[model samples]
Target: MEAQVINIMTYEVIGSKDKAVAVIAYGVKTPKKLAKNIMKTHKNIKSVLQKTGERTGVYRIHPCKLLAGNKNTEVIHKENGFSIKVDPQKVYFSVREAEERQHIANMVKSGEKILIMFSGANPFGIAIKKKHSDVYITSVEINPAAVAYANKNNKLNKINRVRNICADIRHAKLEKFDRIIMPLPETAISFLDAAYHFAKKGANIHVYTFNRSFNEAARDVADTCHMFNIKCHKVGEHKVLPYGPGIYKFRIDLKV
Candidate 1:
């Protein structure tokens, strides 16, 4: 029997693993019906979830509604040959940013001590450690759930070099690192001073920001570096993802 063809224009799969698929429906009148249609079309998709709201708060969590199949929210997300157990409703895990994570990992030097601010689920740190086993990483996050999962993921991934800390980055007493990563795009600029204070001389800092253009992002980075008295040379600029219609999430890599 031939399978029915459902229009895919209304929804797109944001994430998927094993038997589950998470989707964001747009211009669809009956999302539940669409979910059922999605399950009918895709045999591997046993669970279908609809993302309801924007990712918000320090934890960067989004609300999800189960439209079909299993009710479990937790799933094992695999990327770059590593496994991460994430509950999308509880913590921030952007499957979209997997490539960006790898890009950052590729830039790490041997024996470098790295600090990851807002290390939700520890993907960035894990990715870095997986790429460079000689490097040590310190992951700081405010959310307890994210921290717990970070620890779990670290064990699951068998990454011993990453130290997952459950504390706000502003108050955490941290040692200097050879590299600092700020993944929180919307407010990463606000934490530049802290990142600068914790960075070793001749270190690299990768800051993600949402802005209208790369020039705007560079200007912001340059201004922040000037304020901190850190002589920053822009190593690279990359458009990580589209934040909205006009704004984009950009990564500005700097050598201090």
Candidate 2:
């Protein structure tokens, strides 16, 4: 029998022992020290945070996870493009979202601007700029380390089309964007107002949400549009990301 295709993931090897494995969802990586710092920060966020022994050289990381343990841990590396500085333990899941973000980038023409809210390490911006040379992209991230990582990624990728903004989206003075991307499904619903406020009159908004059915998701988008006083329609339906067994998160695009 062939090996089963498990969930998409990213992993890294760390430490002299090579005993420690840093895994990420969909094959992402972060610096070892940064990974350790993330663990420390996780401890500050929750009292029940478990201490995993630190190792050097390699580790796995899952990026899309809001929390650590619930994160996708399985990771493998294929010879596409991989980074070693970003330890796998601290960052992983963004490849699919990166693809979506790249799609948006291709849609951009010269002089077009885009805003990405909840931009973790500015992955969306990176994708956009990487694909579209003439786009001006702005990325906002709340976490300081993530902001740093985003800046580093921009430098690493040698992309000049993005501006990494380090601030909470609620307070950022955002200009109108030709397109907008918010991949944070769990937290994005609450920020529809912000999305509306910064969105251009006819901007394409891509949102991720957890809805049991397509109708539910459509209704959810409708409700959010109504609240924002904007007309909305579904542009497309992408893959349903697996949160766990039987639980799925859908990425739905809306043109508003």
Candidate 3:
């Protein structure tokens, strides 16, 4: 008899010695025996969880159901020579965005203050600070759970100077930053006003948007800048990742 198809998740491994957590897509039928078979074949997977719904509420991560193995969703995800303790069930993280984070870190100059908005798990801060130790970094996020993990991740990497705050970034009083990074793709474009207020003259700002085309994403930023009365010229653009069929997450780099 032919075995039923098992949609083995391609989630990135979370720890050394090949430990991983797999999230089964919503509506996928994963039988118990099949889930066991997955663990047998993919020995590295420490657990299996099912995606239940879209990200909503304060958690801002996919609500998942534990299907097999350990119930603990927390794991230490190693990336770019640093480690991040995260729970996919509690906070949003893109395993594929490590390269993008590193690219952002590469542009940081020493002594420049950096602001990372929607800074979930403080991943971008880790990549940037680990690479450029002299620069000051501050992360503002809304979710308390993510902020807790962000603080732990900072200490996990022995990064002592980062300021992690748990509050809506719009209401947070902050100093102007020399470089600003907005990585929250789903709604980051809508927060350009916040970036504008936090930016220093001639400072760099990076915005990520999800749109049908790269041109549309770039145009959106230009229009937002015009509305905000800020002369944020586009200095760079990049296709960070594909959001869906014909939809992409693009990063637009600007100079204030």
**Each prediction's whole-model lDDT (CA):** 0.81, 0.58, 0.82
The reply for model 3, stretches above 4 Å from the true place, is 1-12, 29-34
Task: Judging by lDDT against the true structure, name the best candidate.
Answer: 3
Q: Model 1: runs farther than 4 Å from truth?
A: 1-17, 25-28
Q: What is the C-alpha RMSD of each candidate to the true structure, in Å?
A: 3.9, 10.1, 4.5
TM-score of 1: 0.90
Q: How many pairs in model 3 have backbone atoms within 3 A of each other, for residues 3 or more apart or on separate chains, i.e. clashes? A: 0
lDDT string, candidate 2, 1-39, tens digits = 111122334332221121123333332345344446544
Residues 1-256, model 3: lDDT tens digits? 1111234343233443356676666666644665576678877678877777767765568887887998886877777678888888888876778889989998999888999999999999999989888889999999888999999998899987899998898899999999999988878888899999999999999999989987899899998888888877999999988766899999999999
Error of 3 at 50 (Å): 1.6
Q: Rank the candidates by lDDT, best first.
A: 3, 1, 2
Q: Per-residue error at 242 for model 3, in Å?
A: 0.7
Q: Where does candidate 2 stray beyond 4 Å?
A: 1-21, 24-98, 106-110
Ten-residue segment with the worst summed lDDT in candidate 2?
Answer: 44-53
